[model samples]
Target: MVLSQMDAGKALTAAAAKGNPEEVQRILEELRVHPDTLNEFGRTALQVMMMGNAKIAGLLLEKGADPNVQDKHGIAPAHDAARTGFLDTLQVLVEHGASVNLPDQNGALPIHIAIREGHRDVVEFLAPQSDLKHATVSGQTAVDVARASCVPHMMDALFAHVHS
Candidate 1:
């Protein structure tokens, strides 16, 4: 009845991948799956939840998943949520203590990716939470990336938040 750690990890990621909240709960409670269990890519369950499973993600956090645990790309679940424009998911991650300004391997933060991908609404929502003045490893600010990536509305949004 008890699965090994490897099996449990597989089940956990599978449940999260399918966005199965109940199954995730069962896995956490019954199968003894660690909430921070990493997959082959070094992504924890919370990071996998960035595929858009807010419910499962919440359960993972409630079970002690570290919201700021970075994956292979050196970013956390919030980066995936931001990249995909999943505002609700991103908010959940942040609410669970995911650091907003943590940059990835490319020195791109969640806000930077949001802007570059033209998620204007996400950009608007996240810009205030961003340390836009903080330059990336490449030395580009969120505003600079906005201007360079041709996301004018994102640029405008960042500017508005700043000037306001």
Candidate 2:
């Protein structure tokens, strides 16, 4: 019941990474662990949630974890979710006010990562936003990445949106 600060932080990080909502809530309520606390990797509960842990992410959000918090890599929760093609997690974060256009350390937004990684669905989800046209650290836009990666479907989707 009385976890040391380090133990509590590790437990919270584990819970978030596992997407265990009940365990996360138990830790927060019983252990009084701060939900927004960052892990050793500079990833918060929300950032871990972006790794496809929707349940834990939702629990953390309900407990007042800041959705907008960026990791040391400058990556928002949405970026992780998008890169991994976790649309459900991405939607939850977005609904909770996660910025889809938030860039990473290299200035790559979620949409940019999605395109480069050949995640067409994620690209589709982000294409409607007017602010996704920005370039990454290498000066490549999402469309450019898609084209260069030879992801025809992704490129088509992006072209449809960018040109329309």
Candidate 3:
């Protein structure tokens, strides 16, 4: 049962998006599909993968998926993980060399997203790795995001990593 290139790309991305690491692994190994294969929509498996599934993230990454791969919007897997509060997945991505400081088209880094979303744990994890002084397109830093969030814990967590 051989699949066309398009079919294989679709299957790979679909399996990743579903968080089925087994299926994703099978598609990559059995189909000889590249881990970075793009779906018909021009998005890679990592871009659409389940943000909470660190296993899937690890599998894709270990198989050569680009850790820095980004969507047209400049949103990387780390950004998605941070947005979804999946600290484990974000950690896996960073371990694979994803840049925590990579900003999206809006100049929003993963830390900014985590802070704005009130994910204190995620913010804490990202704080040390992210450029806290970097501003978003709107000229807002991570501190500004936490301050606007009105979440004291978020500020506390971010401030804990800030040297100054």
Candidate maximizing lDDT: 3
The digit string of per-residue lDDT tens for model 1 on 8-127 reads 777788789878899899999988788988666556677676356778878999999998888667977878888888888887888889888898998888999888888887888888
Off by over 4 Å in 1: none
lDDT of 3 by residue, 1-164 (tens): 88877787899999999999999999988888998888899888999998889999999999999989988899999999999999899999999999999999999999999988888899989898889999999999988898899887988898877766
| Regions of candidate 2 where Cα sits further than 4 Å from its true position | none
The TM-score ranking, best first, is 3, 1, 2
lDDT of the candidates, in the order given: 0.82, 0.79, 0.91
| Candidate number with greatest TM-score | 3
User: What's the distance in Å from true for residue 13, model 2?
Assistant: 0.8
Clashing pairs in 2: none
Task: Find the 10 residues in a row with the least total lDDT in model 3.
Answer: 155-164
TM-score of each: 0.92, 0.89, 0.97
Sequence-dependent TM-score of model 3: 0.97
- Ordered list by lDDT, greatest first: 3, 1, 2
Please give the distance, in angstroms, between residue 78's alpha carbon in candidate 3 and its true position after superposition: 0.3
